[model samples]
Target: MNCHQAYEALQGLIDNSLNKKELVEIKTHVRNCPACKAEYRALKMVAEGLDRMPLYETSPGFNKEVFRRLGLEYKPQRRPAWQSLAMAAGLSLSVFWLTALAAALPTLLMGAKAYKLTQWLHHPELILPSFQSAILKSGLAAYQTLGFAAKVAGWLLKSSALPTQMAVAGLLALVLVFITMRFFRPQTSL
Candidate 1:
C-alpha cells in the first residue's frame, strides 16, 4: 500500500480492525518506511497514553453551578391563586371597557355633550336624546362613505384583469413568504 493509504489505515491497524491481508500490507509498509514507522509509533504512544490516563469525575451539581455562572439558570416564582385570579379578572374587565369605548367612540364624539355623574345617576333619561341624535347622524355618514367606497372597489374590480392580478398577487405573497423564511431560518454549522 502507498504511504497515504497506509497512514489512513493506521488507526484501524492499531485497533486490530484490519483483516489479515491488510494488516500484513500495513506492517510491511511501516517496517520499510522510516517516516511511516515514526508516525505509527507516535500514534500508538498517544493511544496508549490516552487509554492509561485517569478518568475524571465532576463534583455534584457541577452542571447546575456552571449554568448559574453563565447566568442561564432559571427559577420560577409561585403566586397565590387568588392574586392570579384577580389579575386575570382585572385584565379582562379592562379589555372589555376599552372595546366598548372604541365601539361607542364615533357617537360620543359627534354628541359633543358631557354629562355629570350626579345627573346621569339621577336621570339617565335626560342623556338619551342627545346620544341618540349623535348616533343617527354618525350612522348616516358611515353608510354614505361605505357606499362610495364600495362603488370605487367595484369599479376597480370590473376594470382590471382579475385573474392576472390575482396571479401576480399570489406570486408576490409567495416571494414575501420565502424571503421571510430565509431571513428567520436558523443557521447551522457546515
Candidate 2:
C-alpha cells in the first residue's frame, strides 16, 4: 500500500495480472495517493491508446525473416519424453515425503505415550486374524488353515457315516497319501 508498492503494481493493474487482494490494496492506495493516481492515469491512458491501435497482418515468413536478419535459425526447443514422466514421479514422491514428515513431526518433537496408540502399526495382520465369536460366522479364514482342515475332518466323521467321507477322502488323498507313504517309508522301517 506504500507509494513504492503502488507504483510497482500500476503496470500490473493495467494488465489485469495482479491478484484480487493485491489489486484491491493497490487500487485503494492509488485512490488515496495523488502521485500514484497521476501515474496510474498516465499508464492507463497509454495502455488504452495501445489497445485502440489497429492490428496489422504479417507475412507467414515474418518469423523466418526476423531470424534471418538476426543471423540465426528458428528451431523450437523439443522436450525429452522422459522429462515429464520424471517430473510427475518426482512431484508424487515429494508429496508423499511431505505427508510422512507432517505425520511423524509430532512423534519426533515430543514422545508419544500409551503403546496402544501405535499398536496398530505393529500387529500387522499379514494374512488373517481369528474372529472372536459372538459372531454368526460360518466360514473359517486362513489364520490357522491346517487346523481348520482338521476340524472340518473331525466334524465330517462325527456328523456323517465313516464310509462316505472316507471314500471321498481316499480319492482326494491319492497323491498326498502316495507322497507321504513313499517318502516316509524308509524312516518308518527303522
| Candidate 2 Cα errors over 4 Å, as ranges | 58-190
**TM-score for all predictions?**
0.31, 0.30
Task: List the lowest-lDDT window of 10 residues for candidate 1.
Answer: 112-121
lDDT of 2 by residue, 44-153 (tens): 99999998766555665778888999999887556677766655555544443333333333443454453236444333443335342211021112212323443466
Using lDDT as the measure, the top candidate is 1
Which run of 10 residues does model 2 get worst, by summed lDDT? 134-143
For every candidate in turn, the CA RMSD to the true structure comes to 21.8, 29.2
Query: Which portions of model 1 show Cα errors greater than 4 Å?
Result: 60-190
Backbone clashes in each candidate structure, one number apiece?
0, 0
Candidate 2 at residue 183, lDDT? 34
lDDT of 1 by residue, 1-190 (tens): 9999999989998898999999999999999999999999999999999887654556656777877899996454468887667666655444433333343344344442432222232333455577775664554444344334434545666644433433343343454445444543444432
